[model samples]
Target: MEFWRYYRVIRRRRWLILLGTLAAVLMVVYWNYTTPTMYIGKTTLMEPKGQTQDGVPLFQSQMMGTMLDPQLQLSNLGNIATSQKVLSNAAQSLAELGLKMDPEDILAATSVHPERDTNILAIEVTLPDEQEAKVAADAIATEFKKTYDELNNQALKDSRNFIEGQINSTRNAMVKAQDALRRYKEQNGVVEINQQLADSVQNLYLAQTNANQAQINHEAAASRAMKAATELAKLPESQIAGTSISRNPIWERLSESLTDLETKKAAMLNGVPGQPRRGPNHPEVVALQAQINDVKDQLSKTKSDYIASTQQAKNPVWQTAYGNWFQAKVEDVATGAQAAAAENVIKKMKSEMSQLPAKEAELAKLQVDLKAATDTYSLMKSKLDEAKIRENQGSSEVALRTIDPAHVTEAHNNGLLKLALALVLAPLMGIGVAFLLHYTDNTVKTAADAEKLLGLPVLTAIPGSKAHSLPRQHCPEIMDVAYQMLTSNLWVATQNQADNGIVMVSAEPDAGRSVNASNLAVALAREGAKVILVDADLRKPTQHLIFGVDNKVGLTNVLSGGATLEDALALTRVQGLLLIPAGPVPDNPVKLLRSPEMKEFVDQVKEFADFVVFDTPAGVTFPDPVLVASQVGSAVVVHSAGRVPRGSEAELRQRLESIGVRLIGAVLNKVRREDSSSFFHYHRSYEGVVMPQLTSGKKAIKSGPRDQA
Candidate 1:
């Protein structure tokens, strides 16, 4: 999370990140040098106008308007342009132009797009060469137009044929209707008969009315005649023969003369009787009787004459009831004959009326059939004419126009941009990998790593070297300078402590604790401080070997009371410095170090020496360093870079702090000079000449003649 922490991770794993970044950059560069370039050509086309001159549909354009869906037109055109048929034609055309190409290849290289919101198509072709791209684009467009025209012409021809078939069917229907009308007229024997039919119906009705009236009159006359005959039959035959007697004038005159004669006779007879009864035939009586007889005879003759005259008259009125009956009989016979004649007329008229309905219905049906056929025929003829006109005027060529001809252009390349991106990304990828390695690697590789893990200040980074020879074979100044800084930092860090005893320890063995302690003690003595370096690692003592001193009588002998304190101390090669080795590898070194004698030894050593630096065993796996740490005035942990585990360093610091050990600070040993990245690296080059190798019981002075104090 912090900037220095990230920097340390990168610095420690610099080789790993560098190697990975270089590999990625090299791969990108290799790819940038090996691919080919292409060229492009493009063309544009516009759809044909929908109308013609006079703004009316011409050459079946109306049909086209109804059938051609505008939404699908653009898509259809695009598909046709890139189709196999178009491509094949284009390939043939190119071959003729002396530049052969595969149809499939041409199709693969061609692309068509229908421009939105406009009746335009944009066609593009890509090829290895500019001229080839231009040629391919133009050829494809020309072939597509030709194919569209062929398909359109075929469609028009099919439409015309269909219309012709419809016209023929209408003509047949017209002929059938005409024939049916002619047959109906011939069968019924009538042509235009509406007026005649109306006249016949009116005449039949009039005849029926006349016959009905005549029959009524005849029936009345027959009834009167029958009544008269019945009355005459009831009368006598003599009364029937004397029917005209009352209307005779001769008879009336004769009867009047007789009546006058009879009256005169009656008067004469009455006068004679009153005068005297006369004898049998008195004159007056005789004259009256003779007059009455003459008058009676005359009246009879007159009656006979009147009756004969009435009966003999030809056109006389009927005077007798029997005579009237005879006249009524003649009327009844004549009227009955008239009634039969009227009935015959009615039958004839009804027969004529029945024939009229059939004739009128047939005529009406024929008229309707004729009209339907005639109208249908006329319509078909009009449409046939229109079809013919359109066919004659139709154009065989398609209406596509080239708005922009094909042209060539350079294709775009983005290799440089891609190369730049690869360059930038390589280092980032490498840094990410470095961080991963840092997290996975748990060893302490820097003072920051140790400090962060242990929660302690790193006193100094003792610059390390690859050489493994003795101190006499190399310069000790780098080590001496680092130890001198360590010595100063420790004094200041523990100035408040009650004692001047210092113990050096690490979390684990092989962490350079003995080396750092011996160097620090020698450096302190060189500064005019009387420093006693004790090898408190009774289990694995290296101090005696490092200082070239005998380890026969050391800290163990002093603690066990096998030797005196002054006898156990061995003088080191450095002035003002003393060395005490482990007297022997005791069976129980921890018990010997924990004894009261060990505590007394520590007190007495601190009293005699200005600085007592105890080189204890690694405190992590062994408890010797922690035991000694508690007894000493101050404790300092020494960690070797890239050797001590970060976890162990943390544990060691916690244990010491828990036990109340006065932990001053930690020293980062074996730090590479190149990675110091601080002011320490600047001073590392000033390491003086090597120190002279120390011999047995011999005190070695500073090699370069530096002052002791």
Candidate 2:
């Protein structure tokens, strides 16, 4: 199948495409008309600024600290703007307008979208009605600003209070420190260090202890020397030099007894105990005392001499020469004096500290406590002042401005958008439906579809002839176009195959394939080909009228081997053309067509003629054409333009090919010219192929006129 042949079938199926397109387009229009409408509105918002307009001096200084951003003292201002609390107030504010609407209903339709690269936020409101949508947008935006202003004044008060506390605390702390230092000065006298008194007291104790210890040490030394001398004197010459006390007990006892006596005696005053006369004594005591005195003086002088000797003895020197006794005496005296001094100092300090509590660390702690309390009071005071200012600010009225005033629109919907969408989609859907039909029709889809289904090559596409042609007697200009295109297609087809050959034209009954055949024969004859038109559709053939030939003895007489060649071959009125009309409708057309003699007849005709054209029945429904297609050089399919059967072309081509017939081309007869402009895309190449109007060509061809048998 060739491209041109595929194009012919599409041209025939044009009605299906057109009908499908119109149905889809109408449905789209209907749907668009029935859809409901929606309306939208918007209000632009200004960035929130913590600014006040009231003329009041008391709170103005405090407000200086209230900045909306940077510190983010309040970034949730937008949240407050759309808050339910704000919305409720805004709705109340609108009561004077007398539109009864729920706060939730108004809020539901409201939305906020902040702009990038800018501080402005736009509030959009959507509703069933445009006017309502617009009014609600304005209401919500205005109320949001009021609520934010009130919140700002309160925030300023909080800042002022926070700062005031610090100033108060600093002042109070300064006062406390001053008071503490003054009290300490007033309570304690001018203090001085008594270095001379301390040094004299220390010397007095040292001197007393040293004098007493000196007396004790001198006596110990005297006794020890006297005892050693006595021991030496008592020692018999042998053990006398270095004998220890234990080596001679009697001598040692005697020596210790004598030393104790001397030491006790020294502990007394020199003449105070001469009779031990410091205290009262009994008569016996008096006598013993007298004796003791006498002995003491004697012992003293003796001890002195002996002491000198013992002191010269060979024993090494001792520690402090009675160091323990002297040390005990000195320590006892020093301890008493130091105890007295420490008691006096501790007593003085207690008295001084007790007298001036305010001048001590306790005073500083009191000052610090007072400062902290005062600071707290000042801060709270500032907060209270700010709260007062805020309370006043809230009571003040807020100002409002409008960018776009609310107004009713003429149309309540997006009419332009709706109309635009309908226009674009309707036609698109129409074209979509046309393709659906093209795909779903199931006739040969393309030239290739036909080729594959039919196993035959379709050669040409013949534009259809008009049905009104015969009644009008003009042969329809379309008939002439069909004839010319058919001839040109064949001319092009056989130009390479042979100079002249057999050609067949066929279609369903009343499809005018026979008319197509007769006209095509005349057309080829005019071109100077020795053409023979065979009405091979013997079962129900109609070529006799189209060719004005007698059907009494035609193809049947010739093929039955009953009539002479001249009798069966009738000369058509067309010069260089001949017709073997279907003489009578046969009972078994397929059997007659398949006969051996009929095959012989086609071979003989081919030997005699330059070209042979057969007018066979529609190849799709009948087998006659297939049996005859084997006999002709080439058979052409005649399709009614814009009216070819759903599967007929595919089936027709297959019938011819199954019997090994070579299809020459197709004739699209009875074409509709109304939508020719649209179909011109397919018909463009065949433009000059149609004979130039054919007025002169009709006069030159003396073809036989139509005669009903």
- Per TM-score, the best of the predicted structures is 1
Off by over 4 Å in 2: 1-138, 146-382, 390-461, 465-473, 476-482, 488-512, 524-533, 538-588, 600-612, 620-622, 637-709
lDDT of model 1, residue 234: 67
Model 2 lDDT-worst window of ten: 270-279
In TM-score terms, candidate 1 sits at 0.52
User: What are the per-residue Cα lDDT tens digits for candidate 1 across 516-582?
Assistant: 8877887677777777888899888888887677889988888888987777777665677877788
List where candidate 1 sits over 4 angstroms from the true fold: 1-21, 37-410, 421-455, 461-481, 494-498, 508-515, 525-532, 535-592, 595-609, 639-651, 669-709
For each candidate, how many residue pairs have backbone atoms clashing (under 3 Å)?
A: 2, 11
Task: Tell me the TM-score of model 2.
Answer: 0.44
lDDT of each: 0.70, 0.54
Q: Enumerate residue pairs that collide in model 1.
A: 243-319, 243-320
